[model samples]
Target: MIELLTPNEMQLADRLTIDSGIDGYALMQRAGEAVSQTIVAQWPDTKIVAVLCGTGSNGGDGYITARLLKVAGYQVTCFTAGRSAPQSYSERAQRDYVADEGVIMPLETFKADEFQLIIDALLGTGLTRNVEGKIAACIDEVNSCNKPVCAIDLPSGVSGKSGQPMGIAVKADLTVTFFRKKPGHVLQPGRALCGVIRLCDIGIEAEVLEQIKPILFESWPNLWGALLPDHNPDSNKFRRGHVAVFCGNVWSTGAARLSATGAARSGAGLVTVVAPENALTVLASHLTSIMIEPLGNDTEKLDTDVLSFFKRRKVKAAVLGPGFGDQERAKRLVYTVLQSKTEDSDLKTLVLDADAITAFKDHPLVLFAAIEKSGLQLVITPHEGEFQRLFGNFVKGKDKVEQAREAARLSHSIVIYKGADTVIAAPDGRAVINGNGNVLLATAGSGDVLTGIIASFCAQGMPVFAAACAAVWMHAETAECFEELSPAGMMAEDISQMLLKVWARLREMATPSPSPST
Candidate 1:
């Protein structure tokens, strides 16, 4: 369930299932049955339903669902814009169940406003081109209806590989997908549109995954929960690991402080905000558990302070580029930190975000070289704008996951491409797409908080890739819990204070519930 398959992979999975002797028609029948069951369960009172069926296998699913619903005594109207007969088992399904006259109507004859529910079976995961023509009009009308929608597999007109709407796509209230999820179910826009997804086991066996190595994964607690920092009962601050978040000047110190607080809240043994001499006051005023270190913006001072920290203290990870302004100084400091390291210590990690990423736009290769030679694990958090500023269409036509992966390969670092659909991609072609984040996380400084959590996890000894996934999942989890509780509105600073809530929940989930006394 964690592994996200591309459209091609999904097809292969289906073919594998079929080859394993499961009837292809049986698979469609199962899909249709699941869709009908989910729809009935979700909207028990709704009697009038519109089912849009295309000419492909997807249309077959709809035709079967329509017939099943009709038998179930629900008023189901089947409409088709199908140019040709249904494909494969769908043709059989239509011939067997949809023989009643006036049961399946032309697509043009259907009216969206009259339906209490809608099922989008017009398209499946195979779409690569943009949606146009009659189907586009149908999607637009369905979106406007505001009725509950249940989409088969994924919403029609969405690419299972990329999650981009094929021009226009169905906005489903409920998406009933079979077996494993596709990328479209997790990647954004499509993710948002696929509301309340319910994955059903439609006879696709799990053993087929042995031959198929899925590249994309869904980021959630299950992936990194065990990797959560193990703090011994007698462990002190030093045992947890120390993290330093480098700050900009006084006016922009808030971002750095937010990151530092995030680190401290996320169980870092010690957290420090490395600020310039002038920014110390601002940082000191806001931070208590997190310490503040003063360093000059000059490269020499940065090198000395960072190298000294690595030598004297156990500085596990250092963060740069939350709000660090001057590009020249950010560049100089990044290079300085990249070059400072200790072989025996946990000083093999550096995290760059915001200004740190943009600082390397002019000569990204230089930064990449520094990362490659430093022998330090590098993690960069950049939103689309920051990413574009640095890579400049390096992955112009690629999807978010691909874009992040390519950037990571080129930069020789872990890339957290931030957005509603956050993609954490490593240079080794491994990636996890975060699906829980909502618009509430778009507030200012939210990413800074995420950066802090990432640095904190790295300091606490998690592998960089797992740490990134853990941090992203925790950030989204916090937002989700917040929405459930207070939800008045959340800010970056508020996230740090709320970490304890999810942290406790994380520990609870990891701990097994006691077996009931028999």
Candidate 2:
């Protein structure tokens, strides 16, 4: 789990390092040198370079870079947006650059086409508001120039915390950041702007995270590998876990079938689909390994069948809502599933997806209350539209991470905001951003497969947040692996078959490679 810091959190870390006796000026010098070295290494032939500086410390780094680049025999044009106050770091840096025979000009004098390379130090991670006036103009010019851009820390105008642009942002060919990555470097529009991210280790130590106690993370196998369940010779079918998937309708049983197949492939010892009475024969014919259970058409009948299944089978996890055409019936089943109890343990897990999420849009608060009262470990998978329907636009302008975090807090469940950059947020403020997904996962019934994989993990008793992160990574990565073998398009069923290779790959990744010996 690579830690991703918010802007405020990074600020605290810097302050702590300074308070503990590290020189702030020394830190700034190392930062500048990193940027300068990267620029020189990536473009050694380029003789002309433009360093765009602003009023803040980001500009201070730019001043130092200009001085270093001058010493390195490069033709440097240094531009400052505003005058630095006297006796400050920015002023000190400017004076040092001038003493080294490096000339500083106003930002208005900057010419985009005059230089072969551009250095963006106008704004750093601290930017909260939109770029305006001269700074905005400089950014616009830099972007329009189409010159090779090297950004210090982050591109100007992109939010370090949420990754959203503040009016406009610099599109950099290379971005040199320090210590660790901010959310902006990995999150979407900002991610697209930062073409290639280079993490340069300055003087700041990663140990400071202990004091910072960051809750956000970038998902990787290390985050959940230790918590994953493994089967041994003594394990039995019932001992591994039992997963139950609810069917949509006779005409639309494919979605549930995809989910059930996914669960079975994910190491769920027993996978079953609870189907409508009319769809039992269809589901049975299609499914060989997965079992089938007949569900009643009405609310009372569904409640009875659902409770009976739990009582007899000791089901560990249940999935609902994929391809469910009737919203009202889906909502009723969700409520019934919430009220379900199992004798296997004190707690039962439930996953809601697609139609199930939309069914609660009219009165989301009621659904939240029911989940809370039932004491079920709940996870809700909602795309942007389903999220808007259930959570409204109160979080309209915030980035995907913040919106998902808020939704988790409100619903008292782990919120999986499904997207190309999927965000998994736990109720306690812990969050993970999944970066492995692609357009290949945009096909029909893809999310249904994801729902089953998550259920399988929960059934196996993997921790909730860890289960969600693992499930999301597996779902996207399986698609990527499938494309390598069958580059032609893939279907929802194909993903389930690919899960075997993905699981083996995960186990390989989790295993430590043997060290070379004498």
Candidate 3:
């Protein structure tokens, strides 16, 4: 269920299901039944419904749903735009619905205000180009009506591969997708358009995944929760992991403090804020449980001081950027972390965010070369603006997931492309589309909190990809938990404070209970 299939992959799944002795029409029936059941369960009082059908299998699902609803005594109307002559499984569904005396109306005859609910089965996941002509008009008509829409598979004009809208798209109140969800269901305009997604099991066996080998997955704990470091009773502070966070100047220290607290709360053994001498007082005043080390004021000495601190403190992971200003010093610090290694130990991992990402806008190749030289386990978190500043030209036409994967491959690092639907991609082309985030994460300093969380995981010996995915999922979970407390009043600090609660919940879920005495 965590695997996200592309539209083509879904088509292959359908073909595979059909080849396995299950009739296509039978699958359509099951899909229709699931959709109808969901609608009835969610809106039991609805008496009138409109089912919009196309000439494809999606229309077949609508026709079957219409027939079932008619049989149930609800006033169901089937509206067809260009589906006068349905093809293949759709034709069969149309024939059976006609045999049952179901009402089929032309698109012109259908009025949006006349129905309590609208079932949009006009386009499935096969769409590639922008929607146009009569289909576009029908989408416009549905959108203009403001009626509650339940889309089949996907909203009509949404690209199944990318979440972007093609020309125009239906805004669905609920989207019922068969089997697994497509990337469009989770990835921005499409995710927003699909208000509430209901994934229905329509008889597609899980074994098909062996052949498909889908690399994309939904960002959830089930995908990476088991990879989290287990708490051992015998382990001491140093065994957990140590994270060093670089603080900004005196006036801009809040972001670093937020990151330090986040690391401390997210199970890091020790959290230290490596601050400039000018910023030490501000950082020390705000930080209680976390420790702070003061580096000299000279920017030229910053790199040497950081390298020395890493070796002396045996820092397992370091988080750079956050509130650090976009300066040459930031670039130097990144290069130093990337190149710093001792006879006894090397800097194994780092989380680069905010200013660190922005600092390499003109010299990304230099940063990439440094990564190659050191073979650092790196996680780079960048929002759209920061991403545009760094890899915008490289990822111009590609979708978000592809952009992240390509970036990860090019830099030989894990890329956490932050947004409402964050896409975490690894160098090997594996990706995860995060669905746990909400608008509450829109606040400032949220990304800093995320950086610390990821750094903590990396410090604790999680694989780079799993650490990035776990951090993104937990960050979103914190935002969700914050929403439960005050939906609109959430600050970035709330996310850091709530990390322990989220970790407790995840640990409880991962822990096994004693079996019953059978």
Give Cα distance to truth, residue 14, candidate 3, Å: 1.1
Better of 1 and 2 by lDDT: 2
lDDT of 1: 0.84
Give model 1's TM-score versus the native structure. Answer: 0.94
Arrange candidates by lDDT, descending.
2, 3, 1
Top candidate by TM-score: 3
Residue-level lDDT of model 2, residues 326-385, one tens digit each, is 899999888878877532332278999989999988899999899888889999999989
Pairs in steric clash, model 1: 131-166
Where does the lowest 10-residue lDDT sum fall in candidate 1? 509-518
Cα error of candidate 3 at position 304, Å: 4.0
**Colliding pairs, model 2:** none
| Deviation from native of the Cα of residue 241 in model 2, angstroms | 0.8
Model 3 scores worst on lDDT over the 10 consecutive residues at 509-518
Instruction: List TM-score per model, in order.
Output: 0.94, 0.94, 0.95
lDDT of 3: 0.86
* Candidate 1 lDDT for residue 355: 90
